[model samples]
Target: MTDHEDDLGPRVASFRELRGMSLRALAAAAGVSTSFLSQLENGRTNASVASLRKIAGALGVSPAELLDERAAHTRGVLRADRRPRLEGALGVEKFVLSLPPLRNLEVYAGEFAPGASTGANPYTHGNAQEMFVVIEGTVVFELGGERFEMSRDDSIEFLSSVPHRIVNESEAEARVIWINSPPTPDEAHGA
Candidate 1:
C-alpha cells in the first residue's frame, strides 16, 4: 500500500469516532458491510472512490477532507466564520474550536439561548478529562447527583464520563466553552 493508503484507515476511524458513529451505523449509512468498514478502518483494506464518497457524505464532510492528511496536521488559523458548528439539542449552538486530527485536546465554544439546555436528561461520554467555563451569563450544570449554578468566568473540571447537562435558565443568552484532554470520541460531534 502507498503512504496515503496506510494513513487512510486510521483517518477513517478518527472521523467515524469524531462523528460519534458506530461501525455498523456508518456502514449502514454508506451502504457498505460492517466487516468491510472494519477492514477499511483497520488498514486491512482500501476503499473505492464511490465508497469513499459515500462515507464522506455520511460524515457531512467532503472527500478531500478525508483524503488530505495535512488538513489535520497543519498549523493554521481557523477563522471564526469557518468554525464547524455541531448539531445538538435545540437553542444551543456549539462550535468546534480545535482543528482536525484532534490529538491530546479539543475545545468548543457554545452559545445557549434563553431557557436553552443540552437536554432534559443528563448524558456522559468517554473517560477524558473535561473542563467547562462560563464566558457570559449564568448556567445551571448538573453533574452526577449535584447541581451547580455558574456565571461568567466560572469553570468546572470533571471526567467526561460523568453524567452532566447545562441549562441556561436566565432570560438572556449564555455563552460557554468546553475543553477536553485526550479528546472524547463518544458524543464528539454533538453535545
Candidate 2:
C-alpha cells in the first residue's frame, strides 16, 4: 500500500477515538466488518473510497477531513499572505485564515461576487457550531428553513448541523468571515 494509506489508518483511528467510539461500535455504524476495520486502522489494509466515506460518516466527519494532513499539527501564527486559498465553487472564493492542525475551532474568509452563492442546495455538517460575520456588502443566509439577510458587520451563530447556504444577491461583491467550533470536516491546504 502507499504511504498515504498507512497514514490514513492512524488518522481514522484518532478520529474514532476522539468521538469516543469503539472499534466494534464504529464498524457497526459504518456497516463494515470489525476485522476489516481493525486491519484498516492498524495499517494492514487500505480502504476504498466508499469505505472511507462510510467510516467518515460514522465518525461524524467528511472523508476528506480524515485524509487532511493539515489537521495533524497546530500553527501559532497565520500570516495573511500565507493563508491557503481553496478552489471555490460558483463565484465564491475562500481562504483559510487559521493555522494548521485545527483542533477546537477554524476560521475562514470568503468573498462572493455579485450573484454568487455557496451552492444551489444547502449542505449540513455534523454536531458543531458555526458563526458567520459579514465584513462588507450584503449577503443572504438560509439557515435551517429560514432566510436571513445580513449586511456589513452583521453576524449570526447557528448549529452546523442545520442545512444552510450563503448567497450574495447584492449588486456588489460581499465578504464574510466564517468560524466553526470543533471544526468541520473539510480539508484546507495552505499556500
Which one wins on lDDT? 1
**Model 2 TM-score (2 dp):** 0.58
- Regions of model 1 farther than 4 Å from truth: 1-74, 186-190
Task: Indicate the residue-level lDDT of 137 in model 1.
Answer: 97
Please provide, for model 2 over 138-173, each residue's C-alpha lDDT reduced to its tens digit, 9 standing for 90 to 100: 999999889999999999999888888999999999
RMSD of 1: 7.0
* Model 2 clashing residue pairs (backbone): 73-101
Please write out the lDDT profile of model 1 over residues 1-191, one tens digit for every residue: 88888888888787877755689988998899999999999999999999999987776677887787865333347898999998878999999997654456889999999989999888887888999999999999999989999999999999988889999999999999999887878545446
RMSD of each: 7.0, 10.3
Tell me how candidate 1 scores on lDDT.
Answer: 0.85
Q: What is the alpha-carbon lDDT of model 2 when measured against the actual structure?
A: 0.82
lDDT of each: 0.85, 0.82
